[model samples]
Target chain A: MPLDLPNPTDLAVPGFIVLMLAEMIYGRMSGRAVYEGKDTLTSLLMGTGSVVAGLIPAGLGYGAAYYIWSEWRLFDLGHAWWVFVVAFVLDDLAYYWVHRFGHRMRWMWAAHVIHHSSQHYNLSTALRQTWTGKLTPGFIFALPLAFLGFEPAIIAFVSGINLIYQFWIHTEAIDRMPRWFEAVMNTPSHHRVHHATNPDYLDANYAGVFIIWDKMFGTFIPEDKANNPCRYGLVHDLGTFNPLRVAVHEWVGIVRDMWHAKGLKNKLMFLIGPPGWTPDGSRMTSDMIKEDWKRRQAVKEAAPANIAAE
Target chain B: MSLLQLLGSVIAVFIVAAIARWLFPVRFRLEDAHLHRELERVYPDLEPEEILIDRAGNAALLRLSGARGIVVVRRLGDKAVLRHWMPGTKVTATRTPTGLMLDTDDFTEPKIVLDLDAEGVSRTESWLALLAAPDGHAHAA
Candidate 1:
């Protein structure tokens, strides 16, 4: 079942390094404070771990997907031009759900937190990947693509393309694309909003290749730099550069929460609930934060009007 | 790869990470415009570029271009309080393999480990003439 196509992602490694160096040089010349020594090192280390840890699960996942395709595939969609297009589009759609749910559920977030651990958003931050994705059930989202009879190889290749496209959008170097392109594509601007911890920007813009998915799903929030400047990283920052801590902090947090939870239901919620959710109303989720912000904004807006009425 | 092989690779990665962390010796940099504003109360003329902050902006070390002393600032309340390290101040500084620790008669608590590599500590000692002399020298500030 070895799909004879070369690993596109492996070939892109040299390109990633060259682009990072170029970005670093540009950052230095521009004095943008793009890269910090410890932070960059930590990100690269995480990326290295991700690539290594990914090896075992990647093979396992491919095998599972291949098995499903061989046994249960409905249509024999041959390798035609339109088939590539269909594969690319469907793979991206699967990515959206996986990415979306990865943020929404605390269980998936335990693995996804590694990517958001870095405070600074840069090219290296793009390399900051999850080492524990194998533990999450998000890969099951792709099973539908295989069952629908798209080749696993095509799905993998298209996924690689999506990833390579996403790498460049992790930088602050590029601002916005052309109006039409920005509207349609997931450019750096839109992706910045996705990474932002700002209450207005949280849980918004979850698109891989196409911005239209977010637009259609009501998750799109345009990058508003002036009013709500994007603050990168977790709401509560991981203050240490310990690679092990960065990698496993969220997972440890989830375990700790579950241990302290009072009942079976509470423990289940701890695992499956959105982040920042607590049994008591002490902590705030993204929804709560957003609602609170809206209330405050309304109050501020009405203050002047009330004064005028007076 | 088999499960054992995968586990071995994971272990190897951790080992590599540990070695890299040891070799690099992590140091956190703290500099922001808000920090500059806080420090401005003490040194009105202090330039943000000349100041290097550490310990999550709780402590800062500054080298003024024309000034003769090393200025140390500690964040208190909402403001950063500055103290000048004069030529005659008794500053006891120690350097271990891990980091640099500086203690002075001027302050009650020791300046926490200025987490730096061996080379960075030496460079800082050279920059501050007070720490370079035999009287002020212990390891390096």
Candidate 2:
């Protein structure tokens, strides 16, 4: 039987709209959950572009996925309840690494950075996705599942479901879920750290559905609003609200850096290195920023003691 | 996605944006306490000794107590962009009829136009003098 599955994200569209409006209304009344008109518009338009981008027939997305399943699957693991359970969990693990790479590696960050370009964290911001995500080949992470015999349709369906689960976690409306739920699942608080530009929060929390993956992989950092209130958006925030510029800004950065870079090795490093990598170390990468943060923290801690000593 | 869904996404995009504009309509105005909190992450625990806010309250210049150069800040749509002036940094300033025209080599934030009155202009020139060395280079070497 030919595999046919309705995209879960498509079905979730109406719910997405309803939830976004609810959040907006709550923001209005409570004076929290703020959203700027232009930021929200840019986010929504980016979401729309992503949906359109996926429509363009690409061998990389479902095409190559289905091919791997048909020709080279190690086992014909027939559709079972257990198969879907496995696919969902496994796909999320792949998502974790893909997301991690999206931050650490500039080539992938070029596409993934669009989603984080917004300064506001709201449901609409969840829709702020990458127009070129498909081109970056994150799906390669899912290829192992196809080879292990899960159907591409099944993977796509579960992937959509995983995405839908993530949409609710994008808002600042919710502080924390129940302790048990927070322990196992990705929540609003955890996702906030992922979106934050705080030095300590950089490159943390790359979970999809289950927060366990981040914990297992040692990438988890619990949200601490007291010490580090989440500052949304990139480390170097974009100056323009234009959606086109927001989408392709990192790619443009890469092109310019590579063009001026002296050696072929240095130019190659520009593509694979961290987001702010520079030959002369003019720009600070996440690690450098974190080191500086630690140094500053030590200084502050020592100041009180030194005063007492004095 | 269906044609109607496509249309819905488009309409809802604008509608949500419109609702956001209606709900929380406050444009961020730069303030000392607010800038202090925002720049804490960038400058650590250091505090600004002198500060100048533009007439429009969208940009600011600050001179730190022990630091040599002024920090330049310009408000984007929803956030403030901070740049530390250094001796070798590419930057220039020109006086305009209404205020000051500032240019920098930063790719994302290349140009900023600050509208100021006479007193504001005088303070700005002082800040510029503090930021620039005697040889016309930034003082924060």
Give per-model TM-scores. Answer: 0.71, 0.90
Q: What lDDT is reached at residue B69 by model 2?
A: 67
Screening candidate 1 with a backbone cut-off below 3 angstroms (N, C-alpha, C), the clashing residue pairs are none
* DockQ of every candidate structure: 0.04, 0.57
User: What is the per-residue lDDT of model 2 for residues A188-208, given as tens digits with 9 covering 90 to 100?
Assistant: 999999999888899999999
Q: What is the interface RMSD of each candidate, in Å?
A: 10.7, 1.7
User: In model 1, how large is the Cα lDDT of residue B118?
Assistant: 62
Q: Which one wins on TM-score?
A: 2
- Superposed Cα RMSD, model 2: 3.0
Q: Which stretches of candidate 1 lie over 4 Å from their true place?
A: A306-310, B1-141
Which pairs clash in model 2?
A: none
Worst ten in a row by lDDT for model 2 chain A? A54-63
- Please report the candidate that would top lDDT against the real structure: 2
